[model samples]
Target: MGRRSVLPALCLLLLLAWGQPGAAQAAPADPPRAPSTVYAASPALAPGAITVHPYGQLQQSDSLDDYDTSPAASIADPLEPWNRFWFHFNDIFYLYVAKPAYNAWVFVTPHQLRSGLKNFFSNALFPMRFVNNILQFRFLEAGVEFGRFFINTTTTLGFADVAKGKKTIVPVDPTGEDFGQTLGRWGIGHGFYVVWPFIGPSSVRDSVGRVGDCFTDPFFYVYPWELATSSELALRFNALGDVLPLYEDLNSAAVDPYIAMREAYINFRNSQVKH
Candidate 1:
């Protein structure tokens, strides 16, 4: 079916799924935690209900393999009550809404097609990365982005990355640069914490930076609101595939998934700023 038909069906399915009761399964054994970081999930949430490692931080689609729940630095959370409220809000949305819908999309779509969609998204978002690198006067990194963009675009039409591994030349994408990082590099501190529903962990500065990053993305300008919104969401969802299980492990282990994600996000962004 065409995406237009599929999308409405998907939304209807999401509502229906959310209304239905979550199935009961025999509780599984506790998953092992990584040595470097202990990922934590909300105690309120059942271990196997649904796994969602969401974004803005999670949204960026950069490497999340190194998320450390216990971090050395943290942001001001004067908005803790507000943050926690939405944390749970997003938690419920993920538990019932996102996973089921995403699974159906996965079922209908081929594996190769999913992989290509992920690659295509990363490839398409080069402008935001390239510009932020330039804004920070990281010309060398910007040049590298340009090189990778040209090679990847020409070689695969943005469907696959032909840059590195085996017969390698260009390095992997030097991700984590953005308007938020640019603002941080320009001496902007984490101006308190804010957790948005669906978008997850963020700060006042970073939240504003999200608006800045939006301008850098071409998809924001796409005509017909439905296609633009769907394309953007497809980018986030496709990028989320790898990190879902990561959160599953972490969320299962955590006492408070919200705090775990918050601390890690601070540390993650702090590390990015220095680079």
Candidate 2:
């Protein structure tokens, strides 16, 4: 059936699924103490540092393998001169531009404004991801899909690319799982932590997946000149506000933000796989 025809049915199914007796139960909270095995091997760390690194060397090795396998990393191999140039550019944009914007969003905005903006952005993307979530059978995919679709559609006119049949553009469905989740389903464990300049920290697999996602984003579909600059800024501001809580939680809890982020990424990715 066509998407329009199928959407209503999918929404009904989701509503029913969510109503299941146990569906409302919250997920187990992250353990207060790190796993004992982690502490046993790294005796130098204080008690609080135990959960900081879950898989240890094994995780790091696995991340390296994913980095080696990721097509984006291959194309932008750190050793290549052109790639290095681009990486530097990415760093400048992220550190000087995006990071500052994100910081402003967190610290400068009034709480009510931040909350309202986040809701506004999230509400805009809800319809698209809600439909896609059913199609892909992954709710997290639906959630990320919502964020991506909102960003592209509002800021860059990305939805037009999908309408035009640009297969390179990421699909708008939330049900579609990310590459790292796909890797995990294939039984590959998450490995070491690496942070990219603009994109933030992600394993080799997730980093590659983000590139694939960017291609599908609506931003590529819009002529940069055609999109309103103010609208774009608003979207970024809203996006940062929405994720500020997650950033704060990560910083407050972990001794190493990189490792904490990696674990959170993996945990979120794994949740997608199950859905």
Candidate 3:
């Protein structure tokens, strides 16, 4: 059977594991121990500021479409070498590539240019998603498209699944509003934060969303040769340019840097689930 058929079973296993007698016994009786507030050591702020920062932080953190789960989780739990390795690489990418490129684009005041290019790409793929959205009647596609129009247009490009059309597989938009919200509606609580290597801050629910999104992304629809040669490069360039502001905001507002990021990520995922 296809792996897709097994996923429901896998999720059921996770739910069962969480409620199993032995597992419940192992868990603390009172509740899952909340992470310590010691990390809040940065000078106390007004309640309003705290609220705003967390909100801004969540907004900023959600903008990073990439994964970075280790740094956030490491704040509470010890890090494994693999996690560290990925963290180091993430740092390198941020410091050398992402940061510099962002500065260049912002300093050059190319927001409109970048935005237009993103729109062009998105409009090009509009037909595909329009067809998919109509066929499936997934209202989340409308939300995803709305987010693309207002919050960030790059997401629209990410939603395209050209390869699925090529393969005659009906691909769902993983990054669509329905995916994350669906998980929340189904009673899947957001788990602890994790910093995936190339991806940034995400919780268990969002992580699952990421996997599903990848499967449905148009990039996966392309053949390996076409993807590696030019399509990937174009997409990467557009993505970096588009997401520059989000990275800047996250770096600027983070209190514990990564912890603030983790909390914000969890909060955003939870919000998405609620909506």
Candidate 4:
């Protein structure tokens, strides 16, 4: 099927899958605690200082590995004033616009369909994964990605996740790789963090990588620019449909949702880069 025809067909399937009962709910939030494994360059932190360690535990100091989940090590935000402005703007957008759109979809849609869409998008982004895996010099991971894409596309129309199924022989690691991560693997710094309008949280390295990853998307090549852009937006919208319920609980639980999100994003991205 052509790219234009594919998304609509998927949406149709999603609608059909929506009526099934017993939709799963997002799990309740857990109590917060200090982090077990902290990411930092320092080996010899002062006693009671948040225990810090890098990706590889070569520090060989038992005291450093003590996992304490204090707020992640703060990264420099040179544009804090502007970043905070956009941060609140994005929060408002999410609260009023994106969340409502997601809510409307979730009310009508089944969890199964949402999961399938997430899988479909994950599978569809194989080109980005394959290229980045190669760039990272992880030939084995690149080969596994190639295998998963080949099998799933041929057998399941790229929507069904055969590689991830119980009967599957192919090993599929759904974690994505991109130019940003490739840069991370190449020892480039994160530069600085920023809260972009509509795009939410990101860093200088990741933002530039996002630009590069766009060209790696197969839809960019096969579809016209407008259609490709719309298709991507639709996919993202559908993906967001699954997580809408958690936003309220997260906001309620966070002492300061803005800081919580920023710290979480920074720490999470740093871990990804390290690994």
Candidate 5:
């Protein structure tokens, strides 16, 4: 594969890595790698203001078209060596632990059951989204979130996304609305890219957002560290199913997996902070 194809694959895998709350996301495609400028949220279109995805668009306006590999914005990487070490650690962890668990999980659970758990977990995390929306001053979206949460909890007990089809009355569920995006909206810079062990790719701002997200996650309400950690890990395990193909794609295509994944993550997260 040429350099182009590799990063998109890596980007997607990193985007879904760890299944952590407020994790970054991407469409696909990224600019050529440059040591001085591989990762960031840009210096702003003007002081204290950023245009929509200032580095580049995530996907094209046509919506059918995919990826615009324009040159990505820049951020200083003072911790490249440390980040790379953790990157490899995460790679091995995925290979030996996560993939096997995903296989076992898939082999035992039916698809409907898996999806149900996924929906339940998402529904359970409604407070995270709701609070972040409120923080970002997206009161409308916060209200919508509350409405959807009520509908889903009442109708399906949170097992199924029964509120999903009611777009006429209920808005479509939104994704990528969380503490990280809220921070970005409030003008916090990405700081720099870092590979956070099992959490995979993240930046300083996003890392902080993850901590904030933990406060609102349902896992926080559960007692006992064992129960909380296990529930959180199971959420990751159930989530692992959706991103397996992405991981394999990254594995197969990445020539210099670390740099490719790093740049992919940078570009991907940059793409997300806009919205």
Candidate 6:
């Protein structure tokens, strides 16, 4: 594949590795985990904020659309001009494109099949969890991740997760780690906030770290190229079903969706590193 063709696969891997809460669940995506105390209030009105008013006119009017032609008023996200532009791009894409596609996928696909896809995708990315655990020197956690993969892969072909059982001898840790957290654990700073097109919230450190995590994704190997391509697509489209609704809820509740997502994401990433 050419460079352009490879981009989608990498984005897909990062999306999977980016694993939000309730990502594995069937859709009508769960309510967002309650925002942390700090994020419970609205951010100050500022340029480079990622706002999505429910009103269509505001999205098209001077309030939001000016980001394309104007510089962000603050250094909080000096990249805000471009970031706001992409934020709008992603918002429109999700509403008109991704959300509709997700609805159609849900309409035709049985819940059981979707659930299997979820399990299989999670199983396929075992290396992300395994390697990150090792990076953090959590050898025992790494071992549990290792055993969980073999048991799930061999006995049930990843359709069932026996490791999650209440009485199971080997307990699995569902709090999967990623390259971003690994970097943070090693004292890397979150350089600045970024709103990636289609991919959503991230920072400079996490963005670079995301690319690294993609190399650990099993979908890039194991299966034939064509099979690998289709598998990754299926996994992400399925994930979209569980992600878009949460986006809708967050946007509706926030005074400015952009700042809400930015603050929440930063707080969440910091919490992940501290843990």
Winner by lDDT: 6
Model 6: worst 10 consecutive residues (lDDT sum): 20-29
What is the descending TM-score order? Answer: 6, 5, 1, 4, 3, 2
lDDT per residue as tens, model 3, 166-199: 3212323333332434445555555544566656
**Candidate 5, residues 168-235: lDDT per residue as tens digits?**
43342345366766776677777777777677878787777776676666666565545666676677
Cα lDDT of model 1 by residue, 1-275, tens digit: 55444443333221100000111121121233222122233232221222232222333213233343323234566667788888788778776777777788788989889988877877777888888877877676667777778988999988887753433233323343667777777777777777876777788777777767766666656656477767767766865666555555555544566655665566556545652
Mind giving the per-residue lDDT tens digits that candidate 6 earns over 32-118?
Answer: 222222334433433433433211111222454332333232214557667767878888988998888889988999988888788
Clash-forming residue pairs, model 6: 50-258
lDDT of candidate model 4 versus the reference: 0.57
> What lDDT score belongs to each candidate, Candidate 1 first?
0.58, 0.39, 0.41, 0.57, 0.59, 0.62
Cα RMSD to the true fold for all candidates? 12.8, 14.7, 12.1, 11.9, 10.7, 10.2
Candidate 4 deviant stretches above 4 angstroms: 1-72, 110-112, 165-172, 242-250
Question: What global local distance difference test value does model 3 have?
Answer: 0.41
Estimated TM-score per prediction? Answer: 0.70, 0.42, 0.52, 0.69, 0.72, 0.73
Residue 247 shift from truth in candidate 1, angstroms: 2.4
Q: Give the TM-score of candidate 6.
A: 0.73
- TM value for model 2: 0.42
Question: Which candidate should be chosen as best, given TM-score against the real structure?
Answer: 6
* lDDT (Cα) of model 1: 0.58
Q: Report residue 243 deviation for candidate 5 (angstroms).
A: 2.3
Cα miss at 13, model 6 (Å)?
8.1
Per-residue alpha-carbon lDDT of model 4 for 135-215, expressed as tens digits?
A: 777776677788888888889667777877443333333665667767767767677777777776677877777766766
Of 1 and 6, the candidate ranking higher by lDDT:
6
Which lDDT tens digits does candidate 2 get at residues 166-216? 242333322333334444444544443345544454555555444433333
Model 4: per-residue Cα lDDT at residue 161: 77
